[model samples]
Target: MHIHTPACPCFIIPSSMLRKLAIQADGAERQRLLEQLERSAFLRGQRAASGLAAPGLLVAPGVRHRTVYDAHHGTRLPGKLVRTETAAPVTDTAVNEAFDGAGTTYDFYQQILKRNSIDGRGMGIDSSVHYSKRFNNAFWNGRQMVYGDGDGKLFTGFTHALDVIAHELTHGVTQYTVPGGGLVYDGQSGALNESMSDVFGAVVKQWHAKQTVRKADWLIGAGIMTPAVGKALRSMADPGNAKLTWSGDDQPGTMRGYVEGGDVHTNSGIPNHAFYLAAMKLGGHSWDKAAPIWYQALSLLHPDATFADAAQATVKAAELRHGAGSGEAAAVQGAWHEVGVV
Candidate 1:
């Protein structure tokens, strides 16, 4: 005797039919499926939203004027400008260095890439010096760039280095473009974002200083840090090493060993290494070849792009802007592969 199992007509749902049922389902069983569906849908929404958030609101276009304020070393309580009467007069060294660096960053976008300002609008470039007593870092606080007067033991003043200022300000540029919603600050994507800033920061310095690839120091934050420490904040050429031996390793040497969990600042070394390799291979001023490709990629590509995505975008941009077989394209391809971006 053969026992025939009858198919439950209601349960005989086709794979495609199930989707329709899932959408139309109601009551307890439907609610259960919908909950699962809602969770998945929410996750997707998050990913989509992640791609759209502006890193920071754009201030304006074209580098404008600089306004230096004195934060007075206190985290809270607004401070006044360092007028001669209010505080020690703004030192000539501080004024000139800050002016030149901000100018170069402005010119970099204006002359080369034609970006008006951090947001493609003529945003006034504001820089505040003597931010806090013994503060150790400089940052682009969404509105403007703020520099700290280093602890004097670990850092002098952020304004001391043209590249350091450029680096901080470029963070605003990154904010306006991809924004990354602070999510990209981790993993390979975060590393690439960090490296992009370093790439632009170094290029701004080299372009202004007229340094070729060979002459460029390939170090970020070279002068801001204290002399007692052996190296700069980071080294593009040899990431795992510092300019000064005492500063410890600068970045992760390989992709396999990259620091995970979106540590924006720390994990940036991977892409920094790729930029150095690409610039060196191209054999010229970094701004001349590498900067343009990176800028184009940043502006036109997706915000949540990973290191590999960036590498591929750079390769594509170079090819489209230059030629498929151009030296720039080849360099980008090779550099990404070398850094394990492939």
Candidate 2:
């Protein structure tokens, strides 16, 4: 049996936001937004042809091989090498940010999760910064991370936020870790894929800042957007606050809020909040307990698992890790129920 997964680029900025910006802008700005929309469509077509985002390419083992490339404000990829694993910092901020962001993401998975790298194979982490002129998005292009300077209106630079980098890279992590090779990136499972990235993205930031559940803001892509777009792209702590700064969040905290098999990023708010609730109830560093349980649950998920199935899997994962019927297990169950997923 084969699942027709939406083999598409995982972008930090959702299409809806971009479309809105495009419709509202004028003159040169509108043209740039239209160009971005077209580029995104083109990328989706490429992914559909390629089958996998990160294709099966064997990488050297043992070394934390990392490289940063400069796109020079053009569309070309894997551009000029600007930094390496052992090089000095460059004058370009985007170059340094991509370099440092990839390194930090690698360290989090390596040190906290005990995973070697994106593939757990010590595979090299690479990134391309300043991709295309005023590109308004960042994404895991199936093989590498690409950043845009953002038009400075709706969005700012992409590399400044650790979680944004972590979120995109975690898509690579899922490409390697999910059961049956990967989850079909469509419908409910597609939403779950987005949610998983959000889960780890928030955890990475929390883990790095040494923030406990209460202290963590649970905001994704925070500080990447201009002050005009609100506080952040998404809020796990309160999904309804996802678009507080823009047109207001449409994310619902329950299955009733599901948008008719719509945008994965929007539908993800339910599960995002579920993870937040469980982590909050568990009351500790997200990485220490919540992340491990969610990670373990990732392996158990059916490739096409629905919201109910995922909720059940998390409950099972918690029970497996913290003993059956334990407080942790109850918390997982309670969290799902709170989010109306159970």
Candidate 3:
């Protein structure tokens, strides 16, 4: 699904009366409100963790599995399985696309990364298709990857693209490894996480298609958008210039125009640009060298890593894998400097 725009109101404000009440009151009232917000956030995290804590449905032992549901193509969430372990035949193109995308992601992890599943523990791969009628965004939801058949105007089914599927699944990998990592879904750290997912997402696609760096498009969600929509979600090669807007431009390529604090997806363009530059500078299939360095940086580094930290980590990985003054190390350093990551 394509969330061209944010699904929810994006922000919330406390009642004016409550704010005024707290301002007038002493310590206890303000503390109570603060505590409430903290508690609410904690509860939400707990609930998401609980959902992901167990395997949703085991279709097979390893990462390969398939199942389908009608989804009724409406605005209701998939609450429970209408039928379990029953194969709802791939009746349409959308279902087939989802199945293929899921299998591709599973294979990428198993063969390339050697990760059994999202958590590297042979966790079940679960997906719900035909979700909410006209639901525009596909999400991991901390458990299953849920797909939506688009409104048919701006987007088709999200499952059409393998990279998008892998992208969502990588979010699970981040959660397990960087649990409670202080990369608030905004600013540099948030951008790093977003870029990390894209890096792996594109790598999986490249590995699956056997495309080299010189041959890859380096664009995420290349096929998801319908002919009507003018652009893909975001471009790693060129961030701000990826789309032409009806109103005005959406992103700023450089750090000068970078919005320091925003949602992870929007602010991610900075680091994404850095990765693209790094891959191009390395001058080979992205998955061959650049991807491994980045993966090692992500899995081994601190959770609160910044762009500079990531740059250094890649340099370190290159030095260890190649040599201190190797071409890959120099390319990584140059790319970060080009993007102002240093």
For every candidate, C-alpha RMSD to the true structure in Å = 17.0, 1.9, 9.9
Candidate 3 stretches with Cα past 4 Å from truth are 1-52, 55-63, 66-70, 74-89, 179-183, 242-249
Worst ten in a row by lDDT for model 1: 5-14
lDDT of each: 0.63, 0.84, 0.62
268-308: candidate 3 lDDT, tens digit per residue: 66777777888888867787788877766665555566777
Who is ahead in TM-score, 1 or 3?
3
Question: Candidate 1 — which residues are off by over 4 angstroms?
Answer: 1-63, 76-78, 81-96, 179-183, 243-245
lDDT of 2 by residue, 60-143 (tens): 544567899998988888899989889999999988888888888888888877788888877788899988988999998778
Question: Candidate 3 at residue 107, lDDT?
Answer: 79
Error of 2 at 85 (Å): 0.5
Clashes of each: 15, 2, 3
Candidate 2: misplaced stretches above 4 Å?
Answer: 1-6, 53-63, 242-245
Where does candidate 2 have its weakest 10-residue lDDT segment?
53-62
Ordered by lDDT, highest first, the candidates read 2, 1, 3
Write down the TM-score for model 3.
0.76
